[model samples]
Target: MKKIFGIVVVSLFFLSSQVNAQHKIRIACIGNSITYGATLPNPEKDSYPGQLQNMLGDGYEVMNFGVSGKTVIRNGDNSYVSTKKYEEALQSNPDIVTIKLGTNDSRLPYRLKLDSNFIDDYKALIHSFQQLPSKPKVILLLPVSSFLKDSERQTDEVIVNQVIPKIRQVAYEEKLEMIDLHSITADKESLFPDKLHPSVLGETILAKRIYESVVSKKKMDFDIFSKIKEEKKNSSFYGYDCVDFIFKGRNCKVVKPRFSASGLPWVWRARFFGIEPQADIALLDRGFHLVYCDVAELFGNQEAIDCWNAFYEKMHGAGLSKKVCLEGFSRGGIYVYRWAVTNPKKVACIYADAPVLDLKSWPGGKGKSKGSQEVWEIFKKDFGLSSEEAAMDFKGNPIDLVPQIVKAGFPMLHVVGDADDVVPVDENTKIFEERVKALGGNIMVIHKQDVKHHPHSLKNPQPIVDFILHSVKF
Candidate 1:
């Protein structure tokens, strides 16, 4: 009887251990050299996956299935699907999988086949993970920026212009969550010692980002409308509840939707608030919040940018989406474009109606339009332009910022009155469209045959609404 009791106790203990192990959430880190911690001193302990495990604590099991010089493209030089790590990752039976491949696929030899095989192979890989009995939640990661100056091997331009877009397309089509790792390391050259792989500090940043994305669960009890009501003055905006408040000494307003959207997507209106608000009304109907901050007469100056910067932080903290669709009308164009250029990653898309692209064209009266001398003087003073020549030489116009704006990779749409003497299409939208198209930037221009600047937005508003919805992936 004593021997029988001892056997039963040991068996019970073994079953308890198995149950505890199964309770921990398993995460499989799948990627190329960067995920493998190629250059790090101690990959096992200091790698991003290792660091992620530590950050996730005992409640999670993080497995690093990264292989060096691996490509997600099946026909690429070294296909990730063919690797032993891929098989092991499948065997891990993870609850979540993070795929961060693409760096090696950007190489010249492999890049040639990317157009044909990338999307198909990527889908196949995701399908493989989805077929697993675990049915893991797969997260796509945009590869980190490669600071390598070489044009052939992992160039930033190719990654940004080519590879990243493909990945975004796949994510959108697959309806998968994507973490923009490319933007995290962009312009942070010091963090990448060899220009190819991230240093230990950089790995820490990546790990923290992944942890925030996968491990941290946002509190569902917090309601944005409740918070707004508690803190701000309430009003009505086109039949919707509008909350008014002061942020950074600027008058701000947020129009609440009857039902909040899945992502809490929002449109940030610059300058104009309620004039010809068809698009705003439509967006509100589709469960989008309409937000505005009074930066009028600021002319998209440094002060305006600073005000917007603070306003953005407050809204993001209030649980709004990380990116916003920008709407600019007439002079409001300056405000939206200026802010978008500075905070490119923060913007999802831009819709400008009769926008003032070049200050010299409208306010400065340097172009065909009969300009506003009063506003021009204010603009010059705001920009610190000592004379007319200085204003002429000013390169801060949206037209001048086309390259940076294009590189930011956000789509733009312009609605212009072909016959308007004020903020003429020829000087503003036409020039902007031409320049944007030249650089392979995405821009759509809608010319209202005989309309003027007085009428802003479309009568139907369907096209504008569709553009915003598509850009934000709603």
Candidate 2:
């Protein structure tokens, strides 16, 4: 009788995963624990994926195929039958497949030994998804945060630390769309009453995360002034539970496949979102800041003005905020060089990737100037410094600013490639790293021995993210 009942239940769950025949956007929930939400009062209404399907509106069908204790390599049954489930998902011909697995595999921050072991398997799964006749888009959910020790608190520590890293490595390798669902989950209070399965509310938050990643499109910066009108919060960066720190300046921000830590809540900042944290840990966890201005030094261009104003207004209204982290890629690094010199006291750290710091070494303007006409125009217009005196303002030059950097001092993550064509990896990062290191400063360099150009991000992204996180306090 139990076997018959189990078969009937599996049949219903399987049927629920299939689309409603007319076909809108078909999504698949392929994981465990949170996907099933057996701990919720009502599994149908409470499972994260189930709630996701509901919140996603009338145009979507989501199939939840999460088997608790299932890992990517093997679900402890030591069989590749889980691949069959994916095959079934492919047969359904869904437009997208969202994977939230790996929490079971890592369970703690450092259980995995070799990168290839777990990463290769994850790559295999991606390849398997690609093998689908429909060729659905694959979006990986960066694993959520776990307890500090993972002892009596959670069972998914391995996914949070070890497996998720490998998965990210694979995402970069495969070029799949990814979201920061894990970070959102981590920042959120407990979703489980027993410290494991998600409550019904937790399901809603997770589902909304997947929906926003696949469906929504938002500009980099959203409205900040309006939110301040809506929520009566205190402090410059709101320090409440379940707030996304990175969204402090921007209003409608969306992190389409999030990058890493704290990237989750950020993913849904532009769209309607939710964060269901556990009751006990709600107040204990210090939430993420509302706004963070990365590379405010690059605030010279018309491109940088709007973002600066938004951040400035928020900081002004809130009184004072944390030191901003300065991040710049390619020529934008030159802006970092300038911002750092003028306001070193306000900056927390520097992240320079292929920055063009010197006009003499590698002249500026992104392929705009036929000669130096555009250059002189920028010097006169953008700097607002008299052309005659601009030359003497040698202090703002990134190359010249090394002395100030040494004196003011901040940690830096320098990533450059030996064969970069766009920014002449040699002139930009090589010399900058050398000069900065010569002074007393903390700098970490990821020099790709043979790789070329911007492609270096595909190699190691965590180091980039680590630099961003390290720039913050509390």
Candidate 3:
């Protein structure tokens, strides 16, 4: 009798181990139409969650619990919590949850006073998942950008101004990892033909980014994981998180302050969105919000100007400071000056470093160094002008607008490399500085004696930060 009992016990233990080994990691993807595979050829097999499941392979089960036209805000038009799918999702016993619900909430008839309950409702939803026996890891997703205006139904303006900010605040407060869906999908206009939903290609990209974010944790070797763990802990102490949005089909990101600064000053960064973070991070700590619009390869033409105008209006409507201090690096010079020259009253000051003031110099490739033929082609295509037309059109270039910029009485600061051959100082900033000085404008140029355009900002960004703080007077 004892031997028989021992055999049964050992068999039961083996069966339990096998069952545990076969248990898959379950991911619950909860959201609205986009997650429902709206406008897709086949939502069931091609939705972002569907594609994500394939990427995650046989080890994971990704369930799509997306409800159509639902809002995360409980008081809004169609509250996600009120939906049957929300209950279904909770019952799935998921080990991970990804919430992507802000897009629908941004639509009209739903968003009326929706901002008030967004945080509390979002927290409640997260808490519901957290209270589960599995205690799933929750990841919040910022909604994708809207390419066209649908004021009667959906407007990206609200998403950019209201939804995204509240979502960021929730992520920061809850100490959860938030993904920048807006930034990744903002430039892929073709992927969203109807201007709202993602195509098959769009779903693929979304799935890939999500998969990368998930597997990045497991794939990290022991050494790298330890290093990252330490850095992440350190970052929590000194770092302020950034909320990214899509403004007029352009990617715009804002880093909020823990403590509000006086008058709410913001610095607008141009070109190379997240390359150098020392200055922007410092400014965030000092209670200044940092913003960026990805108008890459446009070279600041009329099209770029119009897009930026829309973004500025949205920000202003959202109660951002009236006058934005502009920070331009490399080719960003043109974007800075064009906007300022067109709307001088909207600009407080300008800080341009290794700026390409002339299209004919860098992108146009007409000057000292071997310029970018790729950029030159893009430049002409953007302006709808031939080489000769672009050359004749000095009206569009920043170099010709120096007198107007100077007359506007906005203080200017330029940090340039004297030895720079690409975007030669003689052709760009040197000439602008001389022209501005001749026109009796307030301009300051810091010459990095032996440096080239490669190293953009100062190692110690104190001077740059000081210039911005003084200019904004925050």
Which one wins on TM-score?
Answer: 1
lDDT of 1 by residue, 312-369 (tens): 9878888889999999999999999999999999999999999999999998887788
The residue-by-residue lDDT of candidate 2 on 92-145, one tens digit each, is: 777788887766665422243335456766777777777787788887776555
Which segments of candidate 2 are over 4 A away from where they belong?
Answer: 1-20, 75-84, 108-116, 148-157, 218-474
Residue 321, model 1, lDDT: 92
lDDT of 3 by residue, 2-59 (tens): 9999999999999987787569899999999899898888898899999999889878
Give the per-residue Cα lDDT of candidate 2 at 321: 36
**Clashing pairs in model 3, backbone N/Cα/C closer than 3 A:** none
Model 1: runs farther than 4 Å from truth?
1-12, 218-474
Single out the weakest 10-residue window by summed lDDT for candidate 1. 215-224
Q: How good is model 3 by TM-score?
A: 0.51
**Whole-model lDDT values for every prediction:** 0.86, 0.54, 0.79
Clashing pairs counted in every model: 0, 27, 0
* Top lDDT model: 1
Residue 336 accuracy (lDDT) in model 1: 95
TM-score of each: 0.54, 0.45, 0.51
